[model samples]
Target: MNRCLSGLVGILFVSISLVSCQTDEEIKRQRYITEGILIFKNNCANCHQDKGQGVASLYPPIAGSDYLRDKKSVICLIRYGQQGKIVVNGKVYNRPMPAQPQLSDLEVAELITYMYNEWGGETKLTNVKDVTPILNACKK
Candidate 1:
């Protein structure tokens, strides 16, 4: 009975340790994704729609957009805003995209991660370390 109890305790301890053993990157990724969902819903959903399907010819569709190939441009558009005409998957969208000045660098990172994961077929996190400098360099 003693040996059985000890074995069970050891198993439980191992399970607890394993569950708590997430790396920093993993934790950051989870946090970014969580915040990103909210940001998208609040700021982006009206134009882009909840599923990233934009309105007919007025807004550009985010899901399956060929423009997503230009990660830097997408990042810039999100931060600094977009104007003039742009083409997505052969569709032309001339409406201006308002900048999200309320989003910080970290929030931008989270937003990018969420966008890429949801629409761009990416699984890795877009760390804020990568987003800050890009935002700083925005010409728009």
Candidate 2:
């Protein structure tokens, strides 16, 4: 009986540990996504719309954007913006996208996390630690 009880306790401990880890990840993802939504709304919604649908030919839709294929470029673009012409889901947009120098690396990570999850079909959190170096190396 003691051996059986010990085995059950071990199983319970393992289960709890797995659950704790999963919950921790979920929490981080939720926090990043939440902050990202706010950042997008305040900074990008004017051109991209609340749903990321963008406006006509002048602005590009972020929802289901093919440009998200290049995650690094997306991150850099957020920090330094874009200029000239770029194709989004086959549409051409040439307007200058103003850079947001005010956003910290962490804020950019949160925004990236949210945009990917919401529109790019990503399930992982883009941690600030992972984003800092990228931002530092941005050529734009």
Candidate 3:
């Protein structure tokens, strides 16, 4: 009976250890994603839609978008906005995307992380350390 109890405790310990084994980066990524979801819902979902499927021909879809291929441009546009016509998945959208001047560098990074993970077929985090320089360079 004592041996069985010890075995059960050992199994419980291993299970807990495994659950707690996520790296610090993984934890940060999850936090960024959560914040990003809130930001997207509050700021972007109106045009981009909740699932990023976009709104008909008026807005362009972010999911599986060819525009994502130019990540640097995407980052710049998110903060500075876009004017004139743009093409996504062979569809041309002429509407201008307003700039999100209120979003900080960290917030932009989080938003990108969420967008890429959820729709851009990415499984990694977009760290703010990497975003700040790009944002600084894009300042007009």
Candidate 4:
């Protein structure tokens, strides 16, 4: 009887643990979205607009930007801002967006995750580990 009770308790414990873990991804996704939205509003909303639609040829749209579609390039550019000119979404945006080195890797990841999931782009759930290498590889 004791053996059966112990087994039942262990199984119950494992079931509870698994159930708690089930929502971790969703929680992380929500947290990333929240963090990204805050960062964007604070730093990017002025130029990118609240909806990520660029400011009429001044700033380029971030929602469906080609730069974002190329994940590697976008990650690199974010880690190290590009100068000169670049074309995004069939339009040429000439302004230089300064690199956000002050932001932590986790913050940057959350920002990227939010951007990818938000607006009209593909929903990619980015994490700190996912983007850390990109930052490390950047020459700055």
Candidate with maximal TM-score: 3
Question: How high is the CA lDDT of each candidate model?
Answer: 0.91, 0.93, 0.95, 0.81
The CA-based lDDT of model 2 is what? 0.93
Q: Candidate 4 residues 19-138, lDDT tens each?
A: 788677778888899999998888778878999888887788987777776776777777677788888878887988888677788888888888888854655578788788877887
The best-first sequence of candidates by lDDT reads 3, 2, 1, 4
> What lDDT score goes with residue 132 in model 1?
83
CA lDDT of 106 in candidate 1?
A: 91
TM-score of each: 0.86, 0.83, 0.93, 0.78
Question: Model 2, which residues run further than 4 Å from truth?
Answer: 1-21
- For candidate 3, the clash count comes to 0
lDDT of 1: 0.91
- Write the number of the candidate with greater TM-score, choosing between 2 and 3: 3
Clashes of 2: 0
- Candidate 4 displacement at residue 96 in angstroms: 1.5
Off by over 4 Å in 4: 1-22
Per-residue lDDT tens digits of candidate 1, residues 56-109?
A: 999999999999999988888898789999999998889989988888889889
| Candidate 1 lDDT score at position 4 | 94
Off by over 4 Å in 1: 1-18
lDDT of candidate 2 over 98-136, digit per residue (tens): 999989999999999999999999999999999999888
